[model samples]
Target: MEIKFEQKIPVLLEKAGKKGMTYKELSIKCKAKKEEGKYFRLAVQKCKAAGLILEKKGKFFATQSKGLYPAVIKRLHKTYGFAERLEQKDEVFILGSKLKGALAGDKVMIRLSKHTRGNLPEGEVISFIEAGEVEFTGIAHLTKGGPFITPDDIGNFDLRLEGSVKGVADGDKVTAKITKRGQGHRDLRAKVVKSFGQATRAAACCEAILNLNGVTPEFPPQVLEEAKFLAQRGIKHKELLNREDLRNEVIFTIDGADSKDLDDAISLSKYQDFYILGVHIADVSYYVREKTALDEEALRRGTSIYYANKVVPMLPKELSNGICSLNPDEERLAFSAIMTLSKDGKLLDYDFKKSVICSRVKGVYSEVNEIIAGTAGKEILAKYRDVLHVIPLMKELSDILHHNRKLRGAPDIDTAESKLILDENDRIVDIVPRQRGEAEEMIEEFMLTANEAAATLAKKLQIPFVYRVHEYPDGEKLNVLKETLQALGLPAREIKGNVPSKVLSDILDEAKGKPFYPIVSRQVLRSMAKAKYSETPIGHYGLALENYAHFTSPIRRYPDLTIHRILSDVVTQKRSASDIKKRYSEFVGRSANASTEAEISAMKVERDCEDCYKAEYMEDHVGESFDGMITSVTSFGFYVGLPNTVEGLVRIEALPEGQYQYDGLMELKETHTGNAFRVGDAIRVTCSGVDVNAGNIDFVPAEPESDENG
Candidate 1:
């Protein structure tokens, strides 16, 4: 019997390997064991019944192979607890379990149990794989019994303070590190590392954002010293001897009114029937050389971060805003793209060169817009007479290019508001709406034309380069969008198959004048995939083009700087194709990871600053009534966006005088009151109070108006 059982083991292993059997296959294999030699079958049945070997799909296999069990697992590695990976199964297995010990960005391995009759995969905790190294930033609360740390960020779970680190008092913002993990408990043990006062809002906010996004804000002291040395060395005109000289040309820069770090400038002239345009980008690679401390630090950062009131620059301030900045009247070094184009925005010929340029004028969008509108002020007219002469012509050419872009089905998103004015204390005072004026549009059109020309030239030259790519949206998400639009009585047929940008643009146009327009537009934008940097050209869906790259903004973006270095080497014949390919492949992989991390970090910081401002703004308006729109709907409650665009939750239990029942079919309808509230519905509410400590704004329904007619 023992021999027979041993002989059957190999057959079972082969069957399990072939069929991909889950645990249910073991029971069926046990029935087959009963049919073999009776005594041997009984012994095999006992082993199967003991659950030593399990079946997955249809075949039996040992549960423990290489001391690791076959268990389905999901890991969360982002601040939002987004699932990052699945092990052994295509499905996520931790949808309903209580994440007791897990933080927002923890990674845990799980084991799958038998599925119920109607349910899908059921998972149990296997082991904690990795704990994210995020230090909690908040005010420390002290009590006679013990101290506790309540985080400023709402999503974080609270931490229990140790006696040794309980020196921090209540209302003092502090940073704490987890000292011990609590199993099946609400709070984890932590030690306060630093206590900061109220004056540290900006610094603390920066730290919180960096921690949440898994980034380190401060550079190593060695990196800082290296940057200082590089800045001091600066760019020299002697180095420009081997490059093109574009100082004779009328090059100008157009940016925001408050911008200081000017990275790119433009010059244009009529060369016979075609127009010659020059795009002069600051030569960041010349200062930040390869394998150096500055380069290493810049590579880690990948891109500069612009928040509401501050900038976390990729390079040190001395370099970013001083030496490398293309300030007017300064002889700055540049990597230039000179392209000759026809009257219809078609590229005729182009050249990439490392060059020297002296910007003739520093232009801003508003001043240039006035010039284009034939309303230039006396100061502006005197300061930029050459730019004023070309403003009207540039507007005409830009309009033609914009029309061509529409003809090509490029997705043109609506102009969104950007934070403008800030108080002396770095709090948001006002939000200024940004309009796509003629000057801004002209710059954008010229930049796009230059980038496309450079990309096509790189491909023709067979040089390695990094291209910005945005793929098509996921089909599942498109389907969801289709269903949602149909329910909202909007045209959604064009969303199927290969969705053209025209269809999305048309939908956006039709949504105008409706209260739900912004919400719908935001949702449609979210359905699309994020743009990423890669060496291989996958095309850009947003631009509706076959090839696109970032040839501008080299001072702020690493990919553009890398492209500049590659172009410089190509033009000078200093590097071989093989070397370029090897370097580009390595940098592409690193750039992809670094760019993603940088973007995530920037987004977190931007949102954190916005939340801080929202809390500060609400501090003055407690108990005031305002109108709000439903922005999000969930099982527990719905999120409301006030007129100022700050969002807060409206808990279902707080709905006045009504028992709210969430109807899946209707999204959210209260059966008792027969009142429906879906996303985009407007309602009146009053602020209860601002929870500054937790960064939360609480609201309740406002009282109805009195009947003056009666």
Candidate 2:
């Protein structure tokens, strides 16, 4: 197998890299036997499929289309779109009208727009490559000829029924699937795939929100059966062979009060001037092996989505919340990362092990916060008796680690989250800030250490691995970020070529305690590159880490599961270097690409759901006064973010009648009055209206306390 892979893949690419060759000529030049030539052909096909090579005129060659490449269209609103080219660091902008009716999230071929030659690259989407199945859920209305559906997405385009409708009527919530896309002036035609009850019901509305973003609540029968079988099989003694038995260890899991899909547990002890920290993650790979039905479904989900009211888990509950969950007093299989850190939190040494651990208690974050505060109630103290000494030590080490990262210039932009409270009727009753106390930060510190250790180990092994990498943000994003920094009182001279990550950290520090700090932090966060699973190591810019990967939550994230499978083979199974590389080289490339797209989709779904709930909540608060900060200023209007994380718009008309101009500094200025509304400005406003169907809110400025219409 080694010789076959090397000769066919590496050697073939190496030869073709020098010069192009036809299939017959390549085999003869490599001096391979007739049987080996067939293997060579298969290898070329794999590389081509994996996008490693390109073919033309019956000849094979290495892929070298470096500049101005085909990309998936990510439209910003309905007016314009952007695509980050494969070869360039900046994104190319395409006007929506020039898109020829291509919708957002569609894959299309784009090239630099005609007559474009400057630092900022402009592009035009010339053709639609694929529509991604483009299915949506919405209300279906009966017309004279047939049925039509109004989509629930941000897009307002309507679809006409392609066939005779059955089981669905006017105002019925239904899932419409696009079989073919419509061109300009033509209405989109679709088929009703599934039907819920009336679109007015909250259940149908919420379910439509999920379906609109392509999240299905149900899994395939095969995946469910596989999960059930794995749960019933149980952890056998043979499976526990060559694993550590840490059942007697005083370990515990700390998570949100309502969290049930637990996956990690912590154990801590002091060893002289060092601390022994053990982070044991559920061994999800043991049950959902590679190439299985369960694994396929998990890969498609990418990460477990934490919705407001429910969780759309990557793995079925039979595995995620059953045997794989680190429930208290249950002997569960886990992959342990045991590290010895100095008193100052520098990792001295570390080792990985496959183990069986039984957590003494599943401590909730709130209760643990009380324990850390030395204000534990009798019930809490009694419940945590087995590991009362461990909480303080965990806190100490966590503080050390947090300090260490701060010293390394890691940006501290961890924002407070809002916990939505709902009554029994599924109506939002209240929204409160879910503050992250010592317990939550402590777990985060430990998990970051373990993830870094995992990445470092995989790098040393020299095998293909998935790394959680955050590259430096570039192009127009950096330009606005500079303006934002200057807005935070940073000297314009401080913003220069290749702005260091520490600079962003310093800016965030300066903005702290200011009313605009949240929006500034949010804008900078948007300016930074999104962290994603990569097949290669790209130093994480945000965390200021050289090596990092998602290794803590395998039960929820697919990348962590992939890393665990590799760790099991390299560390425990002691596989050879070549064997590991050959087996996972293709996997690393394919899974990284697929998982990244899946994760982006899941995040969109979660965002849309939250927006829906917020709209529903504010439906009652219309005309009420509240304070909000302007998050962003655009040509049409400025967006205001409220305390509950709900954002809405105050249009340009609300300002003085003078023509408003958008400054390079990201402020909206009235040309005659010279008055401006800049980002991070707090203003009072009354909710004017709520477009629940579109998840939109309108805000009109409220009068000042001293002046009625100032």
* Model 2 TM-score, all chains together: 0.83
Question: What are the runs in model 2 whose C-alpha is more than 4 Å off?
Answer: 1-134, 143-146, 152-159, 162-173, 178-183, 196-206, 704-710
Question: All candidates' lDDT scores?
Answer: 0.69, 0.79
Q: What is the overall TM-score of model 1 with all chains considered together?
A: 0.83
Question: Mind giving the per-residue lDDT tens digits that candidate 2 earns over 1-710?
Answer: 22464345545645556467787776666566766666666766665544445566787665443222446655444455566554344677766565666665665656675554345567776555456556667789998866788766424556778876878878988887776656641345778888876764444566776776667778899999999998999999887777998999999999998888999999999978989999999999889899998988888888888767788888999988998999999999999999999988999899999999999999999999999898989999999999988988898899999999888988899575767778887777776777889999999999999999999999988889999899887757777777787775765636545677888788788888878788778877887888888999987988889999999998888999999999999767678889999899999877888778888988887776666667777888998989888888888889998887778889888765788998756689888888888887888888888865556788988866686576
Q: Which regions of candidate 1 fall more than 4 Å away from where they truly are?
A: 1-107, 113-122, 128-134, 151-158, 163-167, 196-203, 211-217, 271-273, 434-436, 659-667, 692-695, 707-710
Model 1: lDDT of residue 446: 88
Q: Mind giving the per-residue lDDT tens digits that candidate 1 earns over 127-236?
A: 55456665667777777767887765423445678747534556677777777776732457778877754523544545555554545657788888987887788766
Q: What lDDT does candidate 2 reach at residue 520?
A: 70
What's model 2's overall lDDT?
0.79
